[model samples]
Target: MGQRIFRRVSLGIMMCVLATGLVFAGSPLPNPPHKGEGILTVNIQGVFNAKVSLSPFKGLKTVEPIATVADVRGNKSAKIKIPAQYFPGEFLLRLDYRAKEADAPYPAERIIYINQQNIEITVNPPYINNDEKTKFNSGEKENTVFSAFMKENNAKRMPLDLLRQFLLSYDQPKSKLYTEGVKEFEQRRVEYNTWLANQAKIHSKLYVSRLFQFQYIPAIIWSGDAKERVNQILKNYFEGINFSDPLIIRSRELSRFMDGYMGLYGMQATTVALRDSLFTQAGSVACEKASKGDPQVYGWMVDYFYTGYESYDIKPGITMLQKHINNPDCFTSKKQQITQRLESMARLVPGALAPDFTMNDNIGKSFKFYQWKPQARNKLILFWTTTCSDCLKLVGELSEWYKQPANKKKLDIVAINLDEPEVKIGKWKAVIANLSSWKHLHAEEGVNSPIAREYAILSMPVMFLIGSKNNVIVSTPGTIEQLVKDLK
Candidate 1:
């Protein structure tokens, strides 16, 4: 009997492993996509189950497979047709070898361009297939040009990355070595820019291809006093960008570029107040440059910049929109979106009072979030959900900290569970039971709750520190320990 049972278990295991392999062995999508939709056909090099995705994915990463296009068990070759609207834009085609399998190291993702043509790629590694040809059929020119640019970029970027790293290691204006490094870096930049210029001429039709490369120029210019060259170069750098091109607005590359640009320029500001000021000035400069060209392009950029900063420090973004987005009515549709973005942005900045709402607790008791309810004390308002594994651990840590007798009277703690109705309250209640000292409430409509929308609560678990006076938001900390330290 023991041997028979063992034999059955062994057979079951074998079947399971075989089934997993077959599933990832290049199966067709269940629902066939039409030809009009953007199609991707790849003759891959390896025979492993790989995870592929289309970008611009959120936060520069795809945590889960986007089943619509690239999330399949791609073996040696995989073909997929995307929606037609995804064309003539820049996108990243990311692949992770053995991604579905456990303990695989995440590799650097590769970016691909879409030039209103069906994409066909041959994915043999250069080492394996010496010529590194594209085995699949269409969009050969697009792939070939991009392949060369990428090859050149990698070769040239090694020195730049090392120089940039070294420059960042020292104090910016204080160190002579930093100054010397910047001067040397400019020589390399000029050399690389000349090469890029020659390529841009050859691939003139693919001018949109250069916007991202143009965006990669480091914004590390700093001076103790006003430096003419740095200012002039930055001014020319932004001005030369053809925001008149439709592709500049269609792609998220500009948005991504502006974020890093703002960070770099903001670092030059010695004070927090000055940082915000510099960021606002940078936005104005960016918008002024775009508005000087096409209204449609200008409007699109403004809308995108505003949208990008919704979860970020929104004041400078708001300032740019309000001050510089004064375009003619030709862009009426875009103006409306920008207006809506402004209204939302106006309410979500730090030091602004948090809006109030009422929600029921486990026993139907009402909890109100308003000014001065938890009198004479500051508050830590955490927007959390039970379904999130990260939130679970975070809440558990905060609960553990709350258990200490020393922290009980430190401040009032508000934990609003925004878990969907489908998720049983039992899990939420279990977490709350462990955190007995805190005021617990349920977001009546989960993530879309009125309070959540008022706060622009897109992701969790986000925390806002509220001051005692006027119930104004004091800080936004990522962890419980940070919140504790901020409170102290």
Candidate 2:
């Protein structure tokens, strides 16, 4: 009896210890345990299965996100671990919580500065300067200059917005409101421009592209005369832009700004031909500027337009793209990426013959994607991965459409899973259990699947629709809604 009592007491002690450990593990500390390494910790609350990414501010380009954490649960306030590898610089830390709940309150993004110190961030929904936690740290002012400039620049944009309206509103330049608005706008513009110019002087580390946009957008827009403004923009659109600066060429915003400037340049264009001529000349002059001055700039712009124009079914800059692909100055990998981009984009376009491939279904049945019955309906090929949070959401969306009896007969879905072998198919089966009624296939070599290569699956949740007759390509639908609309 004594031996039995000792065993029971020991078991109770073990259970107590486990319970304590579980509680400690379940409740994440405000910050991750500092291991004396350079791991930057992020504590997230009120969100689940979030994707944490860091995009560094090294150049004037869109810095592709560096995925620090793929999917993290929000329960118990999770702490994300990220080691700082970038040189002391500013970066955008984005928490893509779309994978979790749609109504999650956390701000999607925040700017972070790495100063060779282990930084800790506590992310909660509706990120405000003050609520319950610590106030905004003023000690880190130099690190925060980007946000400050952005705020100031946004505040000063009212004058430009007014000027644009003034240009568009009045045919008569002599109207009292238009004249006075333009004059007042011009004065504010000078003051704003001076302020932007001094930002870099104030914070030596301020990104040049940010300052350029804040400066040039105002200088070009807040003019007193419409015709003069148009001419000034067209003639010197890229005057202050230093193409050699890696920041300008790398900034996606700069390219977006250029795209907008062309559209905004001649808002009161008299004819369709006039607008076309203006845009065509914009591209031509942009190319010439790059060709003569900065080859890198020229190459970057060629890529920008080649990829950009193709999406709208407009192939304006193919010649330039081809030239850069063959250019000696271009890196082999970039050239390859550009070449692949052309081939894939050109192939997948509407009316192009759909790339054909064979893959084994969930039941080990080999099926050809192009084999659709002549009398049957259109075909929809969905490329997704088991681990892709977006893809999981997409499956749910498609499943909803498919549940309707009408959609099943109107469209045939060929769901392809790009989950590798080592991950095991059990988890994938569990995830796709809801869509069991639909035909699903698994790639033998996940990412290197032939279909993915043929279509160039650069991103997840990519869908293709094919016309029933001759299996002609229809369109790459962005959403299930688009696919349904196209079917009609």
Candidate No. with top lDDT = 1
Which regions in candidate 2 have their CA more than 4 angstroms from the true location?
Answer: 1-85, 93-109, 113-141, 144-172, 198-213, 218-235, 248-320, 330-334, 344-356, 368-439, 444-447, 457-488
For model 2 the local lDDT of residue 235 reads 64
After superposition, candidate 1 runs with Cα above 4 Å error: 1-35, 48-78, 94-110, 123-139, 153-192, 212-233, 249-253, 294-300, 303-320, 323-356, 362-411, 419-434, 444-447, 454-488
Model 1 per-residue lDDT tens digits across residues 208-308: 45443442443345453334423444455454466555455555555555544454454456765675576567667777767776676676556555544
- The models' CA-based lDDT, in order, is 0.58, 0.57
Consecutive 10-residue window with the lowest summed lDDT within model 2: 17-26
lDDT of 2 by residue, 281-347 (tens): 5566766556654565666666555444333223344434566567665432346655765677767
**Per-model TM against the reference:** 0.63, 0.56
**Candidate 2 backbone clash number:** 11
Which residue pairs come into collision in candidate 1? none
